[model samples]
Target chain A: MSLPRHVIAPAIAVLAASGALLRRSRRRQRSRNPRPASTREWTRHPVGLVAGREIRQRLRSRSFSISVLITVVAVAAIIVIPSFHHTSALRVRVGVAPGTPSATSALITRDAHALGVVTTITSFPSVSALESALHRSVDLAVLSSQELLTYGGLGASGSSGSNFLTSLSLSLGQASALSAAHLSPSQLQTLQSAHPFRIVALHPPTPRRSVDPLALVGVIVMFMMVNQYAQWILLGVMEEKSSRVVEVLLSGLRPVEMIGGKVSGIGFVALLQGGLTIASALIASYAVGSPLVQTHASWTLAALILWFLLGYVFYSWVFAAVGSMVERIDQAQSLALPFSLPLFAGYIYSIFEASSTTVSTLYRALAYFPPTALFAMPTLVSRGDVGPLGFSVSVAIDLVTTVLVARLAAGIYRRAILHTGSRVRWGDVLRRGR
Target chain B: MPVLDISGLRRRFGDLVALDGLSFTVASGVVTGFLGPNGAGKTTTMRAIFGLVDLDEGDIRVDGHPVDAARRQRFGYMPEERGLYPTMKILDQVEYFGRLHGLSRADARSKGAEWLTRLGLEGREDAKVDELSHGNQQRVQLATALVHDPDILILDEPLSGLDPTGIDDIGAIIVERAREGRAVVFSSHQLDLVENLCDVVTIIDHGRVVAHGTVDELASAGQPRLTVRVEGDREGRWAASLPGVTVSEINGGEVRLVLEDHVDTDLVLSAARAAGRVTEFSLHRRRLSEVFRESLS
Candidate 1:
């Protein structure tokens, strides 16, 4: 903090005098007619200053430096490894009855391939063989009947055999009735040509797990990243408070500004890391030149970034304020334990929802809360549970939660930072009486 | 007008009366030393005045108005424990403080550099704060307090870790600030520095003001008793025999005698001459330290 005497002396003298002069002017006004001192005009918010300091300090630390490297590698691995994956496209296996060497089999084979399946057809002559074949069903199959003219689809369920069975029964009954009544030949021909529309489509209950795999990956990734970075905010605040440097800042600026600045600055850094991860994942994936990159992965990555911001804001204040309550760095983790509970729950729930393709009301409720929203919303978006309306609701809730929690945290910090004897009690902090 | 106007301040921490009716005033352009022993509420008092600590009773005003948002920005405070970010570069830390005190970015940066130079920390501006010697850290701390050009500086234990050179660095800067008409208040255990630097002092003990006002006023209140020694007076038993005199010490050709305050100086001198040639005479106006120690005890 020094310069040579020659340069510093003049500058000091000028500054010292000017500072004195400015002070005198303010004093002179009060002497003539005093105004209230606590007025808003006197406020010099410490937000930007403290935040900028925290950011610059943290950026220079070994942790942030190391974390940057880790984030890049992790992102690269996430994107590149997926692109190189070999077992992604879905396929199916099938079985065919023996002695069925015909063009009908070739047509069925062609249709199976078109339906995103790789099929294999084999013979099953005996009941045991047929049962084995049924167990290894190729999604659908053709079965031969005893009578040549009147045959039925067997073993395979639904329309596979229903229409054929209906036709066989009709032929048998028609033959018996013809023997009994000597019916007209024109009517019989009419029945044969009656309705050439014999299209039978089999419907199965929808697949139990049809949720997009891409959405699940994105939602899980985002939830984990946001949770990881919110802790960064917590740990950052704890560092500042424990070092007591924040006290020097508090003297000049209000706690709101201080906390706000810290959240913004470090939050910006966290946001950058989150964005970088997404970008790296995209770039590496694109560089790998996988065709599926844009089809689904891109949207999930974007949701992850947005979720990071909303989540950071909500949890940062809670963590930051909780930080001020305790004075030592050693106590930070324990103090942070309760605050991170909601976040942890959100992360776990999101993962469960993604894998099971089933959303929980608790997770949805957590989503509306600011701290967990960063995790839940992105998960929902990835799970296709979020649309325009749900997004609006979550965003609205996030904003409100941010404002309210910030205010609450600021109040606690302002009161507790200066009262340095012991950890502040939550009830005392919230109490109206000082 | 006084730059700081504090009156009727009373505060308590639970059952402990941390500040019992603490109040004083500081005018611009003079150094006011806040004097107190440990747990005497010196730090607490300063914090309360700066609006960092809430008060239980009475109001503290700056420039005749209550100290509040308007005036707090203009006040610079350095807490007693020497708080600073250990990892932050010297220049960055000071500049950050400047901004917190409301200096614009460019202004903070330039002023911060200028302050670093003035603090004799020019080359070390880029060095991390904790890496510097304790003395250098103290200088940086001072820079933080002064960087914003605060109208009023309330420093707690400003000279604790400073070397003689570092002490001079801060003392010179403070004297310079006071000369420029910015009110400066600092507390220190170093009695001589406070005696030399402060125009007015408030000595507190057990959360109560034991003494306040000028050095002269405190001295007078304690009394102006002088100890004199005469070469031939020997044990000064002869001086003790003198009217209105109590001898307290004797060595070689010297004798320590406490002359009554009401007694005339001429009489003591004449009595000393009668015993022998008076060699040494020292007048004591209750060394502030004595009062402080005795009060605390």
Candidate 2:
């Protein structure tokens, strides 16, 4: 059918207009709805209730307030102290024959100066003297004889002779160059430039991401928050049962709500603390002018938040579930210990992976496990070990794990909350008492 | 309106049965005492009504609508095992629980202050629950349950550890609430208070209803028996001679008799008068405790 431009244009315009209108209407509806809950609506609004209760209650406590203040101060000191006081660049002492190779000597001083190493060349009388000077904390030593280079039972003819030959060759080369060249400094510069070498990197290709200090910081913070709040989840569950308040709480809330609320509550607080820490860290890092953070902080922050969420979902459930095992606070200590080990492993692996991303088999296995998934994936993503699809798949797997663990924890909590003053075994909580 | 009506409820806790076939109605404008001894399932009954404990069968309704576990926001209940965050300030704790019952923060806070003032805890609202004595903590527990303006109040051992003055204060509050046409049911071992406080009483023992009715009606449920303390002819022997009457115990001049439901009290008395001069003559009826005991047995 032949269509006129005016008719077709109006039709297309109408279609576009409807699309815009629909989007606007949907946005309006969302704003109109008072409940800000997500599609993955947390079962634990009560847990948020409980966690708000705990944090608001305990935030004013002598311990909580004091500890946070102290931590901020300590972190500030740690960041500031090393940068200003690192005086290792102040000076370097060297042992070299003064007259034997003036060109080499002059080159050494200039190169050392540029590197921020203040150089002092020494005129040693013998090879032994040069060795002694080298041993006396000189940064570098150049000798005319092979004796200093060759060490043994004061023996070995070939080694000693070759070392001396090498040393004499370097010194003689310096002398000839000085004679043939323009100035002593210029000749020394030539000798120093003769041995330029490439430093071969062991790290694999990571072109998509440049190095990021905040990424490491983000990983550390995520690991810490997950572990800290997991303990809170454990302790909260234990307290509900211990104080015999779960019965009352459970009356209005479901098992899912109970556990979900707890983890959500503690997780919310952890996130709050984490956000504050990050903001302050960025502010401080900004103030001090850290180069990596200045460039990639936004990326670091976004990754951190993602990792924090995934990590919390992964670990918080198990902690809540395990915490359900102990009706008494004392038993909770022992019950929580096994869960702590994975967190410990997560912490260690995260730190190790920060410097280099040679992830161990254990960490790879842990990445598959729910609790440590948050911890492992962030490290992988930070160091360029993960691609987009793989990252998403890992997150999808973690999402499934979160669901399963949530159900498992809820089941465990529901059964044991009523059974006070005794430990609830994992087997019983899962298998039958369910 | 009858605020709460629970019927045909059954619940068990592994091997041991907590409640079996329990039912009762709590009416507005009156205080109802749920009387039971230790392990008498009073707490379980309260919990079951609130859906605090899962029921194996039957239902509970509030204002004629079923009180589902999901609809628990309708009722206010104080469990036997009382709890509050030891670290939370009294005002915050009360307001928090009020909010849980679905009050806005501002509303809850204001209502919390009002209730605290009403509870005579005006100055101590900022104090932590742990700082309060057990009696005051009990008061805080009460404030938390009622701060949200709930229509139904179910309390298990509401006055378990209150001092005499504390008891009087709480009793006055409960009485005031009841006067305002609220449905209030509480279980207590304090018989005197129960007698003074409740209009309707439901007594359970060994997980079964023993006696349940108005105070006077429950007392008058059994047939009247006459106890005659006489100084003349052997009263016990004479009482045994009466139709359908059995003389059980004779302590000095005192005589106890078991009379059939059909036996006339006047006939037994006349016979006792003919046999001896009655020193102490009165209609012997079962007391509330006695009625409970007899029904349970």
- Top candidate, metric DockQ: 1
TM-scores, one per candidate? 0.73, 0.74
Model 2 TM:
0.74
lDDT of model 1, residue B243: 74
Cα lDDT computed for each candidate against the true fold: 0.68, 0.68
Per-residue alpha-carbon lDDT of model 2 for A1-434, expressed as tens digits?
A: 11122123333443565477547744753453223242113222444566567666556657555645655665555455555764344454556643444556665555555445455666677656767666455545666442223232212444432333344445556566566666767766766569768788899574444445666666666665676677777877777777666666665556765676566666666776776676677667667665536543464455557657767866788888877778666687788787788777777776776666365677666656656666776666555565555555666676666667777777777766676555776666666432
Supply the global lDDT for candidate 2: 0.68
State the TM-score of the second chain for every model.
0.85, 0.81
Which pairs clash in the backbone of model 2?
A: A44-A260, A44-A261, A47-A261, A47-A262, A103-A188, A146-A164
What is the C-alpha lDDT profile of model 1 across B1-297, one tens digit per residue?
A: 677877777887778888887767888888888888779888888777766777888778776777765567788888887778887788888877776666767888899999999988888888997798888888888889998798998899999878888888788888899889899999999998888878778788877777778766765564456667777556776676677776544557555455566878777777777877777776766656655664565
lDDT of 2 at A253: 57
Candidate 1 residues lying further than 4 Å off, grouped into runs, are A1-46, A87-209, A284-303, A369-371, A386-398, A419-434, B206-208, B220-222, B230-278, B282-286, B290-297
